[model samples]
Target: MKNRTIDYILRATWQAVSRMYNEEAIKYDASMAIAFALLSIDREGISSTLLGPNMGMEATSLTRTLKKMETKGLILKEKNPNDGRGVIIKLTPLGLEKRELSKAKVKRFNEMIRANVSDEKIRHFIEVTDVINELINNKTIFEK
Candidate 1:
Protein backbone atom coordinates (compact mmCIF):
# COMPACT_ATOMS: atom_id res chain seq x y z
CA MET A 1 0.00 0.00 0.00
CA LYS A 2 2.85 2.32 0.80
CA ASN A 3 4.77 1.57 -2.36
CA ARG A 4 3.59 1.30 -5.98
CA THR A 5 4.20 -1.97 -7.78
CA ILE A 6 6.18 -2.28 -11.02
CA ASP A 7 3.22 -3.75 -12.89
CA TYR A 8 0.99 -0.93 -11.63
CA ILE A 9 3.32 1.74 -12.93
CA LEU A 10 3.84 -0.04 -16.24
CA ARG A 11 0.12 -0.53 -16.77
CA ALA A 12 -0.78 3.03 -15.80
CA THR A 13 1.87 4.55 -18.02
CA TRP A 14 0.86 2.41 -20.97
CA GLN A 15 -2.79 3.27 -20.49
CA ALA A 16 -1.97 6.96 -20.56
CA VAL A 17 0.13 6.54 -23.68
CA SER A 18 -2.54 4.47 -25.34
CA ARG A 19 -5.14 7.11 -24.60
CA MET A 20 -2.92 9.79 -26.09
CA TYR A 21 -2.40 7.78 -29.26
CA ASN A 22 -6.09 7.03 -29.54
CA GLU A 23 -6.90 10.74 -29.29
CA GLU A 24 -4.43 11.55 -32.03
CA ALA A 25 -5.61 8.69 -34.22
CA ILE A 26 -9.20 9.87 -34.08
CA LYS A 27 -8.26 13.07 -35.92
CA TYR A 28 -7.33 10.88 -38.90
CA ASP A 29 -10.43 8.67 -38.49
CA ALA A 30 -8.23 5.84 -37.23
CA SER A 31 -7.62 3.73 -34.17
CA MET A 32 -4.32 2.87 -32.53
CA ALA A 33 -4.67 -0.68 -33.88
CA ILE A 34 -5.11 0.58 -37.43
CA ALA A 35 -2.17 2.97 -37.13
CA PHE A 36 0.03 0.25 -35.74
CA ALA A 37 -0.96 -2.14 -38.52
CA LEU A 38 -0.28 0.50 -41.13
CA LEU A 39 3.21 1.02 -39.76
CA SER A 40 3.84 -2.72 -39.59
CA ILE A 41 3.03 -3.40 -43.22
CA ASP A 42 5.93 -3.32 -45.65
CA ARG A 43 5.98 -1.65 -49.05
CA GLU A 44 6.67 -4.93 -50.82
CA GLY A 45 3.99 -6.63 -48.80
CA ILE A 46 4.19 -9.09 -45.91
CA SER A 47 2.69 -12.50 -45.42
CA SER A 48 -0.41 -12.62 -43.27
CA THR A 49 1.28 -15.12 -40.97
CA LEU A 50 4.28 -12.89 -40.49
CA LEU A 51 2.20 -9.74 -40.16
CA GLY A 52 0.21 -11.06 -37.23
CA PRO A 53 3.29 -12.09 -35.28
CA ASN A 54 5.16 -8.92 -36.15
CA MET A 55 2.25 -6.86 -34.92
CA GLY A 56 1.89 -8.95 -31.78
CA MET A 57 -1.70 -9.58 -32.75
CA GLU A 58 -3.74 -12.73 -32.69
CA ALA A 59 -5.19 -14.26 -35.85
CA THR A 60 -8.75 -13.12 -35.15
CA SER A 61 -7.79 -9.56 -34.24
CA LEU A 62 -5.44 -9.19 -37.18
CA THR A 63 -8.01 -10.63 -39.53
CA ARG A 64 -10.62 -8.14 -38.35
CA THR A 65 -8.24 -5.22 -38.60
CA LEU A 66 -7.12 -6.24 -42.07
CA LYS A 67 -10.70 -6.51 -43.20
CA LYS A 68 -11.48 -3.07 -41.87
CA MET A 69 -8.37 -1.67 -43.51
CA GLU A 70 -9.39 -3.25 -46.79
CA THR A 71 -12.81 -1.63 -46.52
CA LYS A 72 -11.19 1.73 -45.89
CA GLY A 73 -9.02 1.36 -49.02
CA LEU A 74 -5.90 1.29 -46.86
CA ILE A 75 -4.59 -2.13 -47.85
CA LEU A 76 -4.85 -4.88 -50.39
CA LYS A 77 -4.63 -8.60 -49.88
CA GLU A 78 -3.20 -10.70 -52.64
CA LYS A 79 -2.10 -14.26 -53.10
CA ASN A 80 1.44 -14.87 -51.99
CA PRO A 81 3.47 -16.32 -54.84
CA ASN A 82 5.71 -18.20 -52.50
CA ASP A 83 2.85 -19.95 -50.72
CA GLY A 84 -0.42 -21.05 -52.24
CA ARG A 85 -2.30 -20.80 -48.96
CA GLY A 86 -0.82 -17.54 -47.80
CA VAL A 87 -1.80 -13.97 -48.61
CA ILE A 88 0.40 -10.88 -48.72
CA ILE A 89 -0.69 -7.58 -47.25
CA LYS A 90 0.30 -4.45 -49.13
CA LEU A 91 -0.48 -0.85 -48.31
CA THR A 92 -2.38 1.22 -50.81
CA PRO A 93 -1.45 4.81 -51.62
CA LEU A 94 -3.85 5.98 -48.96
CA GLY A 95 -2.39 3.45 -46.56
CA LEU A 96 1.08 4.77 -47.27
CA GLU A 97 -0.11 8.28 -46.49
CA LYS A 98 -1.69 7.12 -43.25
CA ARG A 99 1.47 5.23 -42.40
CA GLU A 100 3.52 8.37 -42.73
CA LEU A 101 1.14 10.21 -40.45
CA SER A 102 1.44 7.43 -37.90
CA LYS A 103 5.19 7.52 -38.16
CA ALA A 104 5.25 11.27 -37.63
CA LYS A 105 3.08 11.05 -34.56
CA VAL A 106 5.34 8.40 -33.09
CA LYS A 107 8.45 10.41 -33.90
CA ARG A 108 7.00 13.51 -32.30
CA PHE A 109 6.06 11.58 -29.18
CA ASN A 110 9.58 10.15 -28.87
CA GLU A 111 11.11 13.53 -29.55
CA MET A 112 9.04 15.09 -26.82
CA ILE A 113 10.09 12.39 -24.42
CA ARG A 114 13.73 12.70 -25.36
CA ALA A 115 13.57 16.45 -24.90
CA ASN A 116 12.26 15.97 -21.38
CA VAL A 117 14.00 12.78 -20.27
CA SER A 118 17.73 12.23 -20.22
CA ASP A 119 19.17 9.83 -22.81
CA GLU A 120 20.59 7.60 -20.11
CA LYS A 121 17.20 7.22 -18.45
CA ILE A 122 15.66 6.30 -21.79
CA ARG A 123 18.35 3.69 -22.38
CA HIS A 124 17.77 2.21 -18.92
CA PHE A 125 14.02 2.13 -19.58
CA ILE A 126 14.60 0.27 -22.84
CA GLU A 127 16.94 -2.16 -21.12
CA VAL A 128 14.36 -2.91 -18.48
CA THR A 129 11.67 -3.52 -21.11
CA ASP A 130 14.05 -5.74 -23.08
CA VAL A 131 14.67 -7.83 -20.01
CA ILE A 132 10.92 -8.09 -19.40
CA ASN A 133 10.36 -9.20 -22.96
CA GLU A 134 13.15 -11.76 -22.72
CA LEU A 135 11.66 -13.19 -19.58
CA ILE A 136 8.22 -13.45 -21.19
CA ASN A 137 9.60 -14.96 -24.39
CA ASN A 138 11.72 -17.48 -22.49
CA LYS A 139 8.76 -18.42 -20.27
CA THR A 140 10.95 -18.00 -17.22
CA ILE A 141 8.59 -15.81 -15.23
CA PHE A 142 6.23 -18.66 -14.37
CA GLU A 143 8.42 -21.72 -14.77
CA LYS A 144 8.05 -24.48 -12.20
Candidate 2:
Protein backbone atom coordinates (compact mmCIF):
# COMPACT_ATOMS: atom_id res chain seq x y z
CA MET A 1 0.00 0.00 0.00
CA LYS A 2 1.03 3.60 -0.50
CA ASN A 3 1.09 4.26 3.21
CA ARG A 4 3.41 1.33 3.79
CA THR A 5 5.77 2.61 1.17
CA ILE A 6 5.82 6.01 2.84
CA ASP A 7 6.50 4.43 6.19
CA TYR A 8 9.37 2.43 4.79
CA ILE A 9 10.81 5.51 3.15
CA LEU A 10 10.67 7.41 6.42
CA ARG A 11 12.37 4.59 8.28
CA ALA A 12 15.05 4.25 5.65
CA THR A 13 15.67 7.98 5.70
CA TRP A 14 16.11 7.98 9.43
CA GLN A 15 18.44 5.02 9.24
CA ALA A 16 20.62 6.70 6.69
CA VAL A 17 20.65 9.95 8.65
CA SER A 18 21.59 8.19 11.84
CA ARG A 19 24.31 6.14 10.25
CA MET A 20 25.89 9.13 8.60
CA TYR A 21 26.08 11.48 11.58
CA ASN A 22 26.01 9.22 14.61
CA GLU A 23 29.56 8.08 13.93
CA GLU A 24 30.95 11.58 14.23
CA ALA A 25 31.72 11.08 17.93
CA ILE A 26 31.26 14.77 18.61
CA LYS A 27 27.90 14.52 20.27
CA TYR A 28 26.43 15.43 16.92
CA ASP A 29 23.26 13.53 16.23
CA ALA A 30 21.40 13.75 12.96
CA SER A 31 18.95 16.30 14.34
CA MET A 32 21.71 18.52 15.69
CA ALA A 33 23.66 18.24 12.46
CA ILE A 34 20.58 19.14 10.50
CA ALA A 35 19.96 22.11 12.78
CA PHE A 36 23.54 23.24 12.33
CA ALA A 37 23.21 22.84 8.59
CA LEU A 38 20.07 24.94 8.55
CA LEU A 39 21.76 27.61 10.58
CA SER A 40 24.69 27.59 8.19
CA ILE A 41 22.32 27.96 5.30
CA ASP A 42 20.60 30.88 6.99
CA ARG A 43 24.00 32.59 7.58
CA GLU A 44 22.33 34.61 10.32
CA GLY A 45 21.82 33.59 13.91
CA ILE A 46 18.66 31.78 15.03
CA SER A 47 16.91 31.33 18.35
CA SER A 48 17.20 27.99 20.08
CA THR A 49 13.43 27.63 20.50
CA LEU A 50 12.76 28.03 16.78
CA LEU A 51 15.12 25.17 16.01
CA GLY A 52 13.52 22.56 18.27
CA PRO A 53 10.12 21.76 16.70
CA ASN A 54 11.43 22.35 13.23
CA MET A 55 14.04 19.66 13.82
CA GLY A 56 11.59 17.32 15.56
CA MET A 57 13.70 17.67 18.70
CA GLU A 58 12.77 18.31 22.30
CA ALA A 59 13.83 21.53 24.01
CA THR A 60 15.89 19.69 26.59
CA SER A 61 17.66 17.61 23.97
CA LEU A 62 18.36 20.68 21.89
CA THR A 63 19.72 22.48 24.90
CA ARG A 64 22.04 19.61 25.61
CA THR A 65 23.23 19.50 22.03
CA LEU A 66 23.80 23.24 22.10
CA LYS A 67 25.82 22.91 25.23
CA LYS A 68 27.96 20.21 23.73
CA MET A 69 28.45 22.20 20.56
CA GLU A 70 29.36 25.22 22.64
CA THR A 71 31.95 23.24 24.55
CA LYS A 72 33.40 21.95 21.30
CA GLY A 73 33.61 25.47 19.94
CA LEU A 74 31.27 24.54 17.16
CA ILE A 75 28.74 27.18 18.09
CA LEU A 76 28.45 30.28 20.19
CA LYS A 77 25.42 30.87 22.36
CA GLU A 78 24.78 34.36 23.55
CA LYS A 79 21.96 36.05 25.41
CA ASN A 80 19.65 37.87 23.07
CA PRO A 81 19.96 41.63 23.58
CA ASN A 82 16.37 42.15 22.56
CA ASP A 83 15.00 39.45 24.79
CA GLY A 84 17.13 38.55 27.74
CA ARG A 85 15.33 35.26 28.12
CA GLY A 86 16.08 34.18 24.57
CA VAL A 87 19.41 32.72 23.47
CA ILE A 88 20.79 33.19 19.98
CA ILE A 89 23.06 30.53 18.52
CA LYS A 90 25.62 31.34 15.91
CA LEU A 91 28.36 29.29 14.33
CA THR A 92 31.91 30.23 15.24
CA PRO A 93 34.69 30.03 12.64
CA LEU A 94 35.31 26.45 13.61
CA GLY A 95 31.60 25.80 13.52
CA LEU A 96 31.37 27.23 10.04
CA GLU A 97 34.22 24.95 8.97
CA LYS A 98 32.44 21.95 10.37
CA ARG A 99 29.23 23.04 8.71
CA GLU A 100 31.01 23.21 5.40
CA LEU A 101 32.35 19.72 5.93
CA SER A 102 28.89 18.51 6.86
CA LYS A 103 27.49 20.08 3.73
CA ALA A 104 29.99 18.16 1.64
CA LYS A 105 29.01 14.93 3.31
CA VAL A 106 25.34 15.64 2.68
CA LYS A 107 26.06 16.46 -0.95
CA ARG A 108 27.93 13.20 -1.35
CA PHE A 109 25.04 11.30 0.18
CA ASN A 110 22.59 12.93 -2.20
CA GLU A 111 24.80 12.05 -5.13
CA MET A 112 24.95 8.45 -4.01
CA ILE A 113 21.18 8.34 -3.72
CA ARG A 114 20.78 9.87 -7.15
CA ALA A 115 23.17 7.38 -8.64
CA ASN A 116 21.22 4.51 -7.13
CA VAL A 117 17.80 5.84 -8.06
CA SER A 118 16.56 6.93 -11.43
CA ASP A 119 16.17 10.64 -12.01
CA GLU A 120 12.43 10.35 -12.57
CA LYS A 121 12.00 8.39 -9.39
CA ILE A 122 14.15 10.85 -7.50
CA ARG A 123 12.06 13.74 -8.73
CA HIS A 124 8.90 11.99 -7.67
CA PHE A 125 10.39 11.23 -4.30
CA ILE A 126 11.33 14.85 -3.83
CA GLU A 127 7.82 15.93 -4.78
CA VAL A 128 6.29 13.61 -2.26
CA THR A 129 8.72 14.76 0.40
CA ASP A 130 7.91 18.38 -0.31
CA VAL A 131 4.23 17.62 0.09
CA ILE A 132 4.94 15.92 3.39
CA ASN A 133 7.06 18.84 4.57
CA GLU A 134 4.33 21.30 3.65
CA LEU A 135 1.82 19.28 5.57
CA ILE A 136 4.08 19.17 8.58
CA ASN A 137 4.70 22.89 8.36
CA ASN A 138 1.00 23.68 8.13
CA LYS A 139 0.22 21.42 11.11
CA THR A 140 -2.06 19.33 8.96
CA ILE A 141 -0.38 16.16 10.13
CA PHE A 142 1.40 16.94 13.41
CA GLU A 143 0.58 19.73 15.83
CA LYS A 144 3.59 21.65 17.08
Candidate 3:
Protein backbone atom coordinates (compact mmCIF):
# COMPACT_ATOMS: atom_id res chain seq x y z
CA MET A 1 0.00 0.00 0.00
CA LYS A 2 1.21 3.48 -0.79
CA ASN A 3 -0.14 4.79 2.48
CA ARG A 4 -0.52 2.76 5.69
CA THR A 5 -3.81 3.18 7.50
CA ILE A 6 -3.90 4.15 11.20
CA ASP A 7 -5.22 0.75 12.30
CA TYR A 8 -2.52 -1.02 10.31
CA ILE A 9 0.18 1.09 11.89
CA LEU A 10 -1.23 0.47 15.36
CA ARG A 11 -1.53 -3.27 14.81
CA ALA A 12 1.95 -3.56 13.36
CA THR A 13 3.51 -1.59 16.19
CA TRP A 14 1.70 -3.69 18.80
CA GLN A 15 2.77 -6.92 17.12
CA ALA A 16 6.40 -5.83 17.12
CA VAL A 17 6.25 -4.86 20.77
CA SER A 18 4.50 -8.11 21.66
CA ARG A 19 7.19 -10.12 19.91
CA MET A 20 9.93 -8.24 21.71
CA TYR A 21 8.34 -8.83 25.08
CA ASN A 22 7.71 -12.49 24.32
CA GLU A 23 11.33 -12.96 23.36
CA GLU A 24 12.43 -11.45 26.64
CA ALA A 25 9.89 -13.53 28.55
CA ILE A 26 11.27 -16.76 27.06
CA LYS A 27 14.50 -16.36 29.03
CA TYR A 28 12.49 -16.62 32.24
CA ASP A 29 10.36 -19.55 31.07
CA ALA A 30 7.35 -17.27 30.74
CA SER A 31 5.35 -15.59 28.01
CA MET A 32 4.04 -12.10 27.41
CA ALA A 33 0.60 -13.39 28.37
CA ILE A 34 1.78 -14.59 31.79
CA ALA A 35 3.64 -11.37 32.46
CA PHE A 36 0.55 -9.41 31.52
CA ALA A 37 -1.62 -11.54 33.81
CA LEU A 38 0.85 -11.08 36.64
CA LEU A 39 0.90 -7.36 36.18
CA SER A 40 -2.90 -7.20 36.06
CA ILE A 41 -3.34 -8.94 39.39
CA ASP A 42 -3.55 -6.64 42.41
CA ARG A 43 -1.64 -7.20 45.64
CA GLU A 44 -4.87 -7.78 47.48
CA GLY A 45 -6.06 -10.08 44.72
CA ILE A 46 -8.56 -9.62 41.91
CA SER A 47 -11.84 -11.27 41.12
CA SER A 48 -11.56 -14.04 38.51
CA THR A 49 -14.37 -12.41 36.56
CA LEU A 50 -12.93 -8.91 36.81
CA LEU A 51 -9.42 -9.99 35.86
CA GLY A 52 -10.47 -11.00 32.35
CA PRO A 53 -12.12 -7.67 31.61
CA ASN A 54 -9.29 -5.75 33.21
CA MET A 55 -6.78 -7.45 30.98
CA GLY A 56 -9.04 -7.31 27.93
CA MET A 57 -8.77 -11.08 27.75
CA GLU A 58 -11.45 -13.58 26.93
CA ALA A 59 -12.71 -15.84 29.73
CA THR A 60 -11.25 -19.02 28.20
CA SER A 61 -7.87 -17.43 27.51
CA LEU A 62 -7.62 -15.97 30.98
CA THR A 63 -8.63 -19.33 32.47
CA ARG A 64 -5.83 -21.08 30.63
CA THR A 65 -3.26 -18.49 31.65
CA LEU A 66 -4.39 -18.62 35.26
CA LYS A 67 -4.14 -22.39 35.24
CA LYS A 68 -0.56 -22.22 34.01
CA MET A 69 0.32 -19.68 36.64
CA GLU A 70 -1.22 -21.89 39.27
CA THR A 71 0.73 -24.90 38.05
CA LYS A 72 3.91 -22.83 38.23
CA GLY A 73 3.05 -21.88 41.83
CA LEU A 74 2.83 -18.26 40.82
CA ILE A 75 -0.74 -17.69 41.89
CA LEU A 76 -3.33 -19.06 44.28
CA LYS A 77 -7.04 -19.22 43.74
CA GLU A 78 -9.36 -18.94 46.70
CA LYS A 79 -13.09 -18.97 46.90
CA ASN A 80 -14.67 -15.63 47.57
CA PRO A 81 -16.55 -15.96 50.85
CA ASN A 82 -18.97 -13.23 50.00
CA ASP A 83 -19.67 -14.86 46.67
CA GLY A 84 -19.35 -18.61 46.79
CA ARG A 85 -19.47 -18.92 43.06
CA GLY A 86 -16.66 -16.39 42.61
CA VAL A 87 -12.92 -16.83 42.97
CA ILE A 88 -10.22 -14.37 43.95
CA ILE A 89 -6.74 -14.61 42.51
CA LYS A 90 -3.74 -13.81 44.65
CA LEU A 91 -0.09 -13.85 43.71
CA THR A 92 2.42 -16.12 45.37
CA PRO A 93 5.94 -15.04 46.33
CA LEU A 94 7.11 -16.28 42.98
CA GLY A 95 4.42 -14.28 41.27
CA LEU A 96 5.48 -11.13 43.14
CA GLU A 97 9.06 -11.67 41.98
CA LYS A 98 7.93 -12.14 38.40
CA ARG A 99 5.71 -9.11 38.63
CA GLU A 100 8.74 -7.00 39.56
CA LEU A 101 10.60 -8.31 36.56
CA SER A 102 7.69 -7.43 34.29
CA LYS A 103 7.45 -3.99 35.88
CA ALA A 104 11.15 -3.36 35.31
CA LYS A 105 10.92 -4.39 31.70
CA VAL A 106 8.00 -2.01 31.15
CA LYS A 107 9.74 0.79 33.03
CA ARG A 108 12.92 0.35 31.03
CA PHE A 109 10.99 0.43 27.77
CA ASN A 110 9.19 3.63 28.82
CA GLU A 111 12.47 5.19 29.90
CA MET A 112 14.09 4.32 26.61
CA ILE A 113 11.20 5.82 24.68
CA ARG A 114 11.23 8.95 26.83
CA ALA A 115 14.95 9.33 26.24
CA ASN A 116 14.34 9.34 22.50
CA VAL A 117 11.00 11.13 22.17
CA SER A 118 9.89 14.53 23.27
CA ASP A 119 7.25 14.84 25.98
CA GLU A 120 5.04 16.85 23.65
CA LYS A 121 4.98 14.06 21.08
CA ILE A 122 4.26 11.44 23.73
CA ARG A 123 1.39 13.55 25.06
CA HIS A 124 -0.02 13.97 21.58
CA PHE A 125 0.19 10.22 20.99
CA ILE A 126 -1.67 9.61 24.21
CA GLU A 127 -4.31 12.17 23.36
CA VAL A 128 -4.87 10.61 19.95
CA THR A 129 -5.19 7.13 21.45
CA ASP A 130 -7.60 8.43 24.08
CA VAL A 131 -9.79 9.87 21.35
CA ILE A 132 -9.66 6.64 19.40
CA ASN A 133 -10.67 4.64 22.45
CA GLU A 134 -13.49 7.06 23.18
CA LEU A 135 -14.77 6.79 19.62
CA ILE A 136 -14.76 3.01 19.78
CA ASN A 137 -16.28 2.84 23.22
CA ASN A 138 -19.02 5.26 22.24
CA LYS A 139 -19.63 3.38 18.96
CA THR A 140 -19.25 6.69 17.14
CA ILE A 141 -16.98 5.36 14.41
CA PHE A 142 -19.84 3.69 12.48
CA GLU A 143 -23.43 4.54 11.70
CA LYS A 144 -25.89 2.48 13.72
Best by lDDT: 3
Candidate 2 local lDDT, residue 70? 79
Model 1 TM-score? Answer: 0.94
Off by over 4 Å in 3: none
TM-scores for all candidates: the values are 0.94, 0.72, 0.96
What's the C-alpha lDDT at position 7 in model 1? Answer: 76
lDDT of each residue in 57-99, candidate 3, tens digit only? 9989998999999999999999998899999999999999999
* Decreasing TM-score order of the candidates: 3, 1, 2
Higher-scoring candidate on TM-score, 1 or 3: 3
Please list the C-alpha lDDT of all candidates, in the order they appear: 0.94, 0.71, 0.95
Residue 53, candidate 1: C-alpha displacement in angstroms: 0.3
> Model 1, 1-144: lDDT tens per residue?
423977788888999999999999999889999999999997898999999989989999999999999999999999999999999999999999999999999999999999999999999999999999999999999999
Q: When superposed on Cα atoms, how far off is each prediction in RMSD?
A: 1.4, 4.4, 1.2
Residue-wise lDDT of candidate 2 within 1-144, one digit each (tens)?
764787787988788777656565245543545444444434577777677766667777777877777777777777988899998888888777777777766777789988999999988988988998889788887555
